[model samples]
Target: MAAAAAAAASPATAPCFPSTHCTRPALISLRFSRRVKVAASTDNPSPAFNSVTAFAPATVANLGPGFDFLGCAVADASLSLGDTVTATLDPSLPPGTVAIASITSPSRPSLATRLSRDPLRNCAGVGAIAALRALGVRSHAVSIHLTKGLPLGSGLGSSAASAAAAAKAVDALFGSRLPRDELVLAGLESEKAVSGFHADNIAPAILGGFVLIRSYDPFHLIPLSSPPALRLHFVLVTPDFEAPTSKMRAALPKQVAVQQHVRNSSQAAALVAAVLQGDAGVIGSAMSSDCIVEPTRAPLIPGMAAVKAAALEAGALGCTISGAGPTAVAVIEGEEKGDEVGRRMVEAFASVGKLKATYTVAQLDRVGARVIATSNLE
Candidate 1:
């Protein structure tokens, strides 16, 4: 059943027009060219809930040397912090079909309206459909509504949060039959649709805390332990502009020198060791040793160099671009250090970079995605 659903929702059959680039804005309309169609199996007749709501945290991907492989969820779930998705089963529509009613953001109405409304085009909508189809609970139709906390194209795993929340909510509404890994895969469908088929951001957004994509062939995810003694904090600074994931990925080099590959591997190993040992200083220092993608992408974000230097000077152990460009992340020792680093980074962006930016402090979220509420309407 899951295989059939995955095949139907596959991106290979999804539409893609010839274009110069695959930026986020450019890909929004492209999704309308295809639709996910599945047959409702008669064996399963489970009663679905009238409504379900779930929340997922924002994640930071490509933590330093662990490009396309590492990420962690932030614990904050404030209105402007992460995403919440609510799904309601619609009695009027046919089974095996889903629709998205609205996409809303507390701060950015224009951006919210600009987001795609089609289920095939929206991450949350696709995630909900995939989860329902995977569970074989096809007797009910549904509408998904997204409440955005993370800014679009802000390099904060905004799409992953929506996908994770929607998947979790849909699963809960149908009795939560799917296991955690299956839910992760459901959310991954959205990532594959919008971004590439990478699991760094999706895994952490669903499983919580720090996740390492150990292998791809078998799709293994290893969740790292976050020891209390580590005293870790994150300072995130998002600029005013957007850095589409497609463009950021396109900037990566097709190949690298043999020695550079060896160095990156060594740095990744050291950083993993530091994380395990709960050494904040070592972890911070190791995070700054990326030699491959960061150098090439750093120029796209104005004042990247100055902001990183300022963060380090203000007691940050290491600072680097979050996932792509435009948003910068700093690893600090504690809350005080994070505050100082955020202030300094903002100042650098204003004085040196001449760009206004917003900053926030967050801890590593251990709970990935969870159902916040459920209702059964008569």
Candidate 2:
């Protein structure tokens, strides 16, 4: 049933266009889970509470060399670039059921219409259901309403943000009983249902900071903290072109030589170390050193090399594709540098790629998903 539902819901399974590049497998098989000894709290639940709203920040995944394992949540001061989910209990519905009431994007109204409302197909619905199952709650039904703040296929962890917000909102509506890891697990399941089975995006969206998925089986996550003195700023310039996650995954090389693997592994380690040390320069250098995935995927995005070069020339510490493609992220230390780097990147996209682009300056979002509001029935 799950396989059928996933196949039916996944756009990657649809027939590819003659102009599209489709080579690798449509689906990824890396599943994630954590074995936690602590059980969810069920005592003294808020019986009167019936609704909750949660927001989860957008994430930059891969971070250069740490493909499929590293990610970090990012947001501007107002926290405007993320997804919101509202979970409301409906007693009239059947028990243990989850449904999507609506999906809307205030910024781009038409984008919402393309999304699915079916609980089995929608990320928010699947995430809510997974949370309920994790909490052992079977007596209540949930109706989810999703508000998308991030653009789809922009390499900003859009799906994961929605899934994280939904899981966090549903958990809060029931009494906020689930542990952080369990919340991540719920989001992971939702991401698996829609995108692929990877925790890099979901984990950081739920737990915040820089998360490294140490293991997939018996999933383990390591959060790296930034040094207090360092203030890291990211200049994210996204072109109008859409690079589907599935297609980007397909573009990746199936295998790499031993030397390249070792080089990438070393750079990944350096990235983690730089993050811990709060060295923006080293972090940027390490991020741009991704030889395998980046090289294979760069050609797929028009003007990518020029954009990266422009960023570097404009005083960016380093620059690379944010996740999949089209959204080039440049690292800088100061806010002023962020603006300059963003301008250069956008110009490169317009001149070289001939694609209009927009840029935003953001910082690391330390807090992941959180409940923004709650309602109690009188």
Highest TM-score: give the candidate number: 1
Q: Candidate 2: TM-score?
A: 0.88
> What is the Cα-based lDDT of residue 171 in candidate 2?
86
The alpha-carbon lDDT assigned to residue 302 of candidate 2 equals 89
Output the worst ten-in-a-row residue range by lDDT, candidate 1: 1-10
Best by lDDT: 2
TM-score per model over all chains: 0.90, 0.88
Query: Which regions of candidate 1 fall more than 4 Å away from where they truly are?
Result: 1-36, 39-45, 77-79
Candidate 1 TM-score, C-alpha based: 0.90
